[model samples]
Target: MDTSRREFLKGTAWMGAVAMAAGCMSRQSAAAGGASGAPMHGFRVAPMKRVRVGFIGVGARGTPAVKRIAQIPGCEVTAISDVNPARLDAVQAWMKERGLPAPKEWSRNGDKDAWKGLCDSDVCDVVYSATPRPLHCPINVYAMAHGKHVLQEVPGAFSLDECWETVEAAEKYRRHCMMLENCTYGEEEMLAFNLIKKGKLGEIVQAEVGYQHDQRSLQYNPRDGVFWRIDRHMKHHGNYYPTHGLVPAGRCLDVNRGDRFEYLVSMETKSASFEAFGQANFPADDWRHNAKMVKGDINTCLLHTAQGKTLSLIHNVCTPRPYDRGNLFMGTKGIYRSYPSLLMAWEEKVGDGGAHKYFDEAKAQKIKEEYRHPFWKVAGEIAKKVGGHGGMDFVMDLRWAYCLQNGLPLDTDVYDLATYSSIVELSERSVNARSSAIDFPDYTRGGWKTAQPFTVDEIDMSKFGFTS
Candidate 1:
């Protein structure tokens, strides 16, 4: 309701394309013929499915997703939509540059409504919503209502009501509504999961992960670059973008699908960064944008799983920190993290500052080798060939199609999205209540216990046709 809050909110329309184009972090397809070297059982992955896709808000985060999806076989981007005519043309131009056909046509609607063509049109069966945080739920509900599946960008919904609303819509529509959270498929994170799963790390008891990017200057990033995160400076806190970091760590720790997030408490530092900027830019009535414009240090939210394990998640955009996630995994046996490098079971002695303290090349090699994912085990060499974020973007796109078409469950499913999102909502509540313990609401309604852990079976690598 305040002016500063409104400042970040106003640009959602203009930057819808830019934000969608950039994507929330980035995702992947493995190459044909699994790579050989390691000695493991037949870890055959299921072939990806072909899901016809339509895209909405192809701007910031959407641009890259469009490009990435196009590269992914089976899934096709049949339609694209955005409110800005210029943006529509821009996306078309990008498509042309990529040698893809131009979309059917451009449908224009006035400013009051989103470009609902792609979502409403029957031309596509699935819609990927890459708009800001606030629109995540609305667009998803719209797509599902129209009998279409939806893959929404993260921080899944802005509020608790929207969360429940999304689950309800999916139930009513009987359509797939998932958060396209890509971090779960990352190489290192998955490696951590494999190591932990094998009991190499012992009874894994606690963890930490986060989105540590610094975006203080995001406010002035051209007309087309504004996004939900910038506006959120004033709305709520707890580095809401925790999904990117947490999803992978959660997989590593088996949160939700295995271990469940029972309760969480959050605390956000004051918005000293936003206040300084407001003082510099606005001389009069800056207080109007006050609360919405800032949160102090970082939005730190901690969660305790139903099994009594604890994990800390940090989400912050205004601070200056290296972009990193997937942190220290401490168990009764050892700890594992990827920022500096990889280490493993008894690879290093405790108190020598952990793995970094006792770095061993042979142990590191074994750690890396032992935990390669099914996708990585088969396509490491090829992923480098058709690379996008270490080939993860490609693998994620293919897996999405593979899961839906074949009727397999996605590794990152609706509950994963909901639970990851709950961390954000609960963090906001925690910060607002003077850092109180905001009990997490089961966004899944009553579906938590029955959810499946995301996995894959024997994939048809013949399609991508592995080389090397």
Candidate 2:
């Protein structure tokens, strides 16, 4: 074999060993619960009339999130943090342009941990972070410890230990730590959730979900002579971004509510796409040309729930494909699929006798209108007007603020954050173990059996002085 191929195999073997070691470590600590040995399920705190928001990493995701939060009724952007001073200035200028006061800035001028200052201060009641994946848990744990609730971007924690740390921190500090999983609030996702809730679809038995979109450009594009995302791709070999597809599917199956993920087995195709792309694009001496991307081009993981339901999850970013989450749910009485087109099929007794084929446009529209989530009915127009990922981002931000203002439980809590994000490392262990099954850590500590499933509680915009 050529030198490059031999090195690649060596690296793969090393990663497999590391995954096994991490699994052993995780199992040793799996029994530990929160600091107080209590679960944070259904946990609530006193209402805040106005939730002061502090933003960390005002880059791609954070900038739009800042804009959306600024528009929410009970939210105020009082503090902002970013390593880049230019981005901080941009947000300050934008706030000034809208006749709002400038937020206090936290930049990496002296201390690299400048964002922590925002968490320590009294300027904000909650901290929202859209920073890199690695910083998510540290920021969240620190924010909660400092008496600030935290809302973090997707994949809330990278490892099982971080997941447990988040759970424990939230329980100890008595502060909220919610993962900002916007897809859960998508129009169709919420519709499916409501359908399942209303029994439109009988007991959901299986689901297929995925995050499949070509991200070669984003991963390979040089930013400061560093391929941050691609570098991680070269190092890890698992479903790094599983929550996008898993959260919605898990919710539809009532995961971490009445049912919980028990074990999962994962497999992946060879890592060829990135090397091929680099060979065609970069020079011989460029790091990309010689980098052996360890992460597979396509990864498929099969997860089994405690209640015997199954979920098939796919993750692929290196291929040429249209964006799709593979939001397909199958139940005893009906089925819903949302890709390429929105379609549904119901048994004769459940619907108008179209079990053999998907509903046409008219029937599909009728069913959608009938089972449309209450959230969309109230905030859909304004959400569309604000526009992020077709209004789901706005709805998510609005719901987070609404719950905080009312002292109600968030739609997605610390347990959801931990459970959904845990798939990242769990899948890696399975993949490295040659598709062996890996059991999930019970982050909820047995609270899931009785925890109430998520409900579509409509927000009364008028109560917050909005006429919609």
Model 2, 321-412: lDDT tens digits are 79999899999888898886788988858655656888898999898998889989877766766678888998898888888888888888
Which residue ranges in model 2 land beyond 4 Å of their true spot?
1-34, 108-110, 222-226, 350-353, 465-468
Give per-model CA RMSD. Answer: 12.0, 12.5
Residue 458 in candidate 2, Cα distance off native in Å: 1.4
Best by lDDT: 2
Full-model lDDT, candidate 2: 0.83
Model 1: how far is 453 from its true place, Å?
4.4
TM-score for candidate 1: 0.80
Best by TM-score: 2
